[model samples]
Target: MLSETNKKILSLAVPAAFSNLFDMIQVIVDMIMLGRVSPVAIAAAGISMQFLGLLYAFMASFSVGNSAVVSRFVGAKELDEASKTTFTSSVIAFLISIPFTIFGVFFSKYVFIFMGSSEEVVKAGETYLSIISLTFPVIFIEFALYSSLNASGDTKTPLKIVVVANVINTVLAYTLIFGKFGFPALGIKGAAIATAISYYISFVLYLYVFLTKKSIVSFYPLFVKDYAKRVLGIGIPAGVERVITYFSFLLFVKMIAEYGTYTLAGYQVGLRIEGLAFMPGFGFTIAAMTLVGQSIGAKNYEEAQKLGWQTAKIASVFMGFMGVLMFLFPQYFAMIFTNDEKVIQEAILYLKVVGLTQVPLAIGFVLSGALRGAGSTKLTLLINTASLWFFRIIPAYVLSKMFGNVLYIYYAMFVETFLKAGILYYMFKKGYWKRQVKWKT
Candidate 1:
């Protein structure tokens, strides 16, 4: 029989995993629907989707900070404090997301310019970016509440909520994109609208859970003054980590762009398909972070370490299997993305290179997730941010400028994944996060 701890972890992991699957179903469906529209549209949506991933990264970071602290409090049986923690985090995320919402909606054209896409790419991406950014507040609030609830051991609620939301998003995106269900065919913008509607629906469902549940946490305006600063303190580092890491990918895209539209388009196809393996790793990472925080909060450092290692092993095993499939059959998968032979060939090479790196990539996610769970976001911030600029982005810019080829561009991704995994494992095994943070709460 499995131990209770193992069983507990799976209870959260299974739902967390499904939520991620639901999230990916939308992406997979989008590629199918939009691929029929035009290769240009597919490429545009693909590149634009990378930028949109920043939204999730930011949400993950905040959720990391929030879940660690909230779970710690809950594990200590401080239910009221835990409730207050979540409510405060949600408010803070809401406030911060508003300006981003405005900028994302109104200034998306500028964002695309920074991304170095062509005129056609810019026009398609800007439309998608603007529409998705409109839902920033909804995204932030839903993420904050859901992460808190999951940490509080209500994992099933968020899973159910996401299932309902993602189904709506997929059906609506398809229907609106194809002029089904009495809807106009709005193309990429229709996908955005579908996503935005789903997020709002998820938020409404989360609100219901927050209000009517067995939660010890509640919204008290005074707690914001008390807990909000700590939340941001932990969050800002995680946020910086994301901003820096993805910026490296942006540089890679820029380098790929110099090779011509087809090359850039190929990289986009490979990337969107590659996202499937990544989602599961992310789910396991979330589980590791939550488990570590709760264990350490209960003064069980050994359990914390065990949780991290086990989750790492699981993620590595899963990603390793995925890496093999991608490595062995890159071209077969490439066909799903595009029929252009040149695009297919370039995509095949890129996929083969990146596929070998997936297990290490999984290790990196696990390490970072473990660090965040221990409330050591500052260390993660410094390491991940510095790596993005120093190791990943700078190298790509140099190689791409001098060599100017797909191989040179993708090398940076390969190197960065290896470096981060090595560094993350070192820091994780160092076990410094076991020290109790003595800040007055």
Candidate 2:
């Protein structure tokens, strides 16, 4: 028998999970379509996508902060404060995306080159990077809107919108990438343009919802500097954490690239396939964050703790099942993304190694989300930075050098996830996060 709290968490988690799954599918569609062109194309798109992930990490800080603050307000029955938070977070997201968008368009080629990619790969990635960069502001806005809705316990709206957006993205990607339906084949660049167009569509949908006041949190014209400070105070640490985390992952990718283009492509495909397992964790993280924020806002610290644990338990079960599938049928999942034998082999290896760590990964994901919701962003920052560098990055570099095999790299990731999961559990149990939240009313 499931508790009512567990049921409510799933009500939010399941839809959010499906929505994230669709987002992953959108990216997979791009990879699958591009994989037919060449492994180099796959590798190029993968590298560019990683850079985009880095940018999104920075943008996610605002969204995460918005969710925490807005959910708390809603919990306290303060709809006005929630609305103000929504508008301010959206503006901040837009403002922060501008410089990154400009740099991505103008100088992204140097980034690929510096990552040690071949000239051909760098050339293939440049246009893709430039086109996608143009959509950063739209992406930021859409993210903020989604965060606000999720905070207000309206996960279904974002889920519905994402489903529609991904359908459009898939159709556009296919038509443009293959020059289908009387369109000229644009290859990787076409895929980028399709993604950019889809983002604009999503932005419009989000704007419509806001303007119509269909969301629980409505937008207003006023800007409060103190509210901005409060949001950013929580967001900056979260953003810095993501920036460092992604930067480290970029270095990790650079190391993988040294193995060969086929290996990098294989790793990329493996990751996309692994999203099947990880998306559930991400979904539960959202649920945990929102529920915890609301609970804390209501001044029910015990309930917030319980919500975090329940979310983690459910996420672990789901992720563990995914791990079983990954372990049993790694090749099947790997093959869906690429036809190359070498790429498939590398991807299979990655799936098998990382699959074993899925449960612990789920724990890390949920607990971290709960802490963030409780406004313990700085704690997460410290733990993630220390553990990531010490347990994953430094060890990965050392092991890769000593063994000169990609297998050691995957092992390092497995070890890091387990250790970090334990550390997060300890922190959650210590209950320091309860003190972090302060009611504004």
Give the winner by TM-score.
2
lDDT of every model, 2 decimals: 0.80, 0.89
Q: What is the lDDT of residue 102 in candidate 2?
A: 89
The TM-score of predicted model 2 comes to 0.91
Give each model's clash number: 1, 0
For 1-441, candidate 1 gives per-residue lDDT tens digits of 977766776776667877888777767778788887777678777766776688777776567778888878876777777888888888878887888899888888776677677888788878887887878898888888878877776767777888898888888888888889788888887877887888888888888777876455545444566577767777778887777767666666767788898888888789877887887787787888888877777777888888898888878888899899999999999998788999999889889998999999998888888888888999888878777777777888888878866697688879988998898898888887766454333
Residue-wise C-alpha lDDT for candidate 2, range 226-253, written one tens digit per residue: 7788788888899999998887877888
TM-score of each: 0.87, 0.91
Q: Provide the RMSD of all predictions against the true structure, rounded to 1 decimal.
A: 3.2, 2.5
Give candidate 1 misplaced runs (Cα > 4 Å).
Answer: 1-6, 34-51, 104-109, 112-134, 181-192, 214-222, 399-405, 439-441
**Using lDDT as the measure, which candidate wins?**
2
